[model samples]
Target: MAVIIKHNELEYAAKESAISEFALLTGKKQSGAEKHMKYDIRMLEAGRFSFPYHFHRNSEELFVILSGCAVLRTPTEFFEVHEGDVIFFEMGPDGAHQLYNHTAEPCRYLDLRTVSGLDVCEYPDSGKINILPEQEVYQTGDQVDYYQGEAQVRDKWPESVLEKSR
Candidate 1:
C-alpha cells in the first residue's frame, strides 16, 4: 500500500550538539516502514550542521533540498546547495558528506537511504567506525587481529574422530 503523510503529521525530534542543532522527522515510527529504504526530513537550524562527515559501507543515501540553503562538504570539496537540489551519495569513502546551514532561516531536506541489515559508518573526523543496529563504535586504531580471542587447538582433529573417519 502506498503511504501518504503530511509534513506536519510526522513527529520531529531535536538533535543538538556543540556544533549543530536540527530536527529530524520520525518517518519509520509514523509510516511503519521496516524493510524498505528509509526516508526522513531534516530541518537544520541556521548555522548548524546536519551531521558529522561520514560514510556508510553498506548503504547509499540521497538528499533533496526542500527549502533554504546549506553548504555540502564532500571528501575533497565543499559546494553550496539550495532548494530543489538533489544529491546522491554512493556507499563508501568517496561518498562521505556533511551539511551546514549558514543561512538565517532553517534548511529543510529529505534524507533517504537504502535499508541494510547491518551498516558500518565511518566518521573520519573522529576516527571511529559505528556498527549500526548493534550500535558499536570503535576507533580505527582499536582493531585487533583476527582470532585474537579464540582458543587455539593444537591438533586439526581428535584421534578418535580421525580413526572414525578412516
Candidate 2:
C-alpha cells in the first residue's frame, strides 16, 4: 500500500543543507519505506554531500544518479559517477563508502536500501558508531575510547599504557 508515484511525488529537500531540493514537503510518513525492508528515494541538488560516510553491517544500498555528477568512495577506491550511472554497495565487509557532490552543478540521485534484520554502522571520520534500531541511526558514541599517554601520570598505568601503545 506504500507506493509513491514518481510523477506525483514532489521533490524532497534537505533541511540541514540549502543545496538540497528535499525539504519536509515530500517526506514520506514512514522513515524507512520499502517492501522486504526499508527504502527511500531522494533527489538531491548540486553541491550537496549526499550523506555522511558510513558502513552498514547487514544492509545493502544502491545509488542511482539521474542527473549531474558526483563522486562515490568505496573501501577499495573512489569513482566519478554521473547521470544514468548506478553504484551498488553490497551488505557488510567493505570499507564503508560515501558520496559527495563536488561539481558546481546540481546532482539528482535515488538512494535505495534494504534492511536485513539488525545492523551497526560506523562513521570513520568523526569516530562515531551507530547501532541501528530498526531503521534509525542511534548515536551511541565510541564504544571504545582512546586516551592520550603523555598527559597522564604514573598511576594511570592502563590508560597510560594504552596511550603509549598507540
Candidate 3:
C-alpha cells in the first residue's frame, strides 16, 4: 500500500519554547517509514528560530526550503536561504547549524533526518548534550568516569550468596 498526503491536507501542530517556535507536520511516520529515515514539514514563524545551534553525533540531516526565506547559521558562517534551496548537514561539529525566519512572512521547510538507532546531539552554544528517543539533556561538563559510581558494589550482594561463593 502507498500513502499519499496532499499538501492542502497537511495538518500542522504548533511547538513553542522561549527561543524557538514552529508548526510541524510529521510525514514519514504516517507514510509507514519505520527505520531508515524520518521527515517532517515545519513552518517557522517570522522572528522565531529553529532548534539551537547543534549537531548530531550519529545522524545526518537535510533541509529543503519550501516556501519562504530564512537565515541559516552554521559553524563558520551565516547566510540566507530561500525557497528552492536545499541544505545538507553532516554528523559532527562541522555540521552545527541553526535557522531563523528573518523575513516578515513565515518560512516553511522540509526537515529530513537519517534514523540511525540512537543519536547524541550536542549544543555548542549551551554546552549541553541531548540524547534522542530518551529525550534526556545533560551538561557536557558533568561527565564522570565509567567506574565513578560503581564503588562498594560487593556490599550489595546477599549474605547467602557471599557465603556460597566463599
Candidate 4:
C-alpha cells in the first residue's frame, strides 16, 4: 500500500526543556511505516537545541535542512548548515552530534534514522546511557560489572534441586 501525507497536513508536537526545544511531526508513524527506517520533521527555534549530544551504537541518522539554518556540533568539529543541506551521521562514537539553532529565525529539518530492535545511545558530556524504545536512561558512572551481583548462585537453588542435577 502507498501512503501519502501532504506536508501541509503535518501536525507537530511541541516539546521544551532548559536547553532543548522543538516541534516534531513523526513522518514514519503518520505514513504507517512499521520498520527499518524512521523519519521526522522538526522545527527548532532560535537559541534552542534539537537533542542532547549523543551517538547511537546501532543506528545511523541523516538530517536534511529544509529551511533556515543551524549549527551542528559533532565530536571533532562544528558545522553551519543551511537550507538544502544534507548531513549523514554514522553509528558509534564518531557520530556523536547535537544541533543548535543559532540564527534568529526558526529552522526546519527532516531527521531520518535507521531503526533497530535495540539501540544504545551514549552521552559523553553527561556520562549517561540511553536505551531507545525502552526509554531507560542511566548514568554511566553507576555501571557495575556483569557478574557483580551473581555471587552464590548455587545457594539460590534448593538442595533437592541441586542433588537431582548432580
TM-score per candidate: 0.83, 0.64, 0.84, 0.88
Show pairs that collide, candidate 2: 12-21, 12-22, 12-23, 13-21, 13-22, 13-23, 14-22, 46-106
lDDT of 3 by residue, 1-166 (tens): 7767676677777654543353333432356654698778888878878887899999999999999999999999999999999999999999999988888997888898998788999999999999996989999999889999799888999888889987
* Candidate 3 Cα errors over 4 Å, as ranges: 18-32, 151-166
Give the distance in Å from residue 71's predicted Cα in candidate 1 to where it truly belongs.
Answer: 0.3
* C-alpha lDDT score of every prediction, in listed order: 0.82, 0.64, 0.84, 0.84
Question: Which stretches in model 4 have alpha-carbon errors above 4 Å?
Answer: 16-29
Question: Candidate 4, residues 1-166: lDDT per residue as tens digits?
Answer: 7766666776777753553354333333466555798878888878877778899999999999988999999999998999999999999999999988898997888888999789999999899999997979999999999999789999898999999987
Over all chains combined, what TM-score does candidate 3 have?
A: 0.84
Best by TM-score: 4
Mind sharing the TM-score for model 1? Answer: 0.83
Q: Which 10 consecutive positions of candidate 2 have the poorest summed lDDT?
A: 21-30
Count of backbone clashes for each model? 0, 8, 0, 0
Ranking by TM-score: 4, 3, 1, 2
The all-Cα superposition gives candidate 2 an RMSD in Å to the true structure of 9.2
Compute the lDDT for candidate 4: 0.84
Error of 4 at 18 (Å): 5.4
Tens digit of per-residue lDDT, candidate 1, span 32-148? 654868878778777777777899999999999988999999999999999999999999999999998888988888998997689999999999999986879899988888888
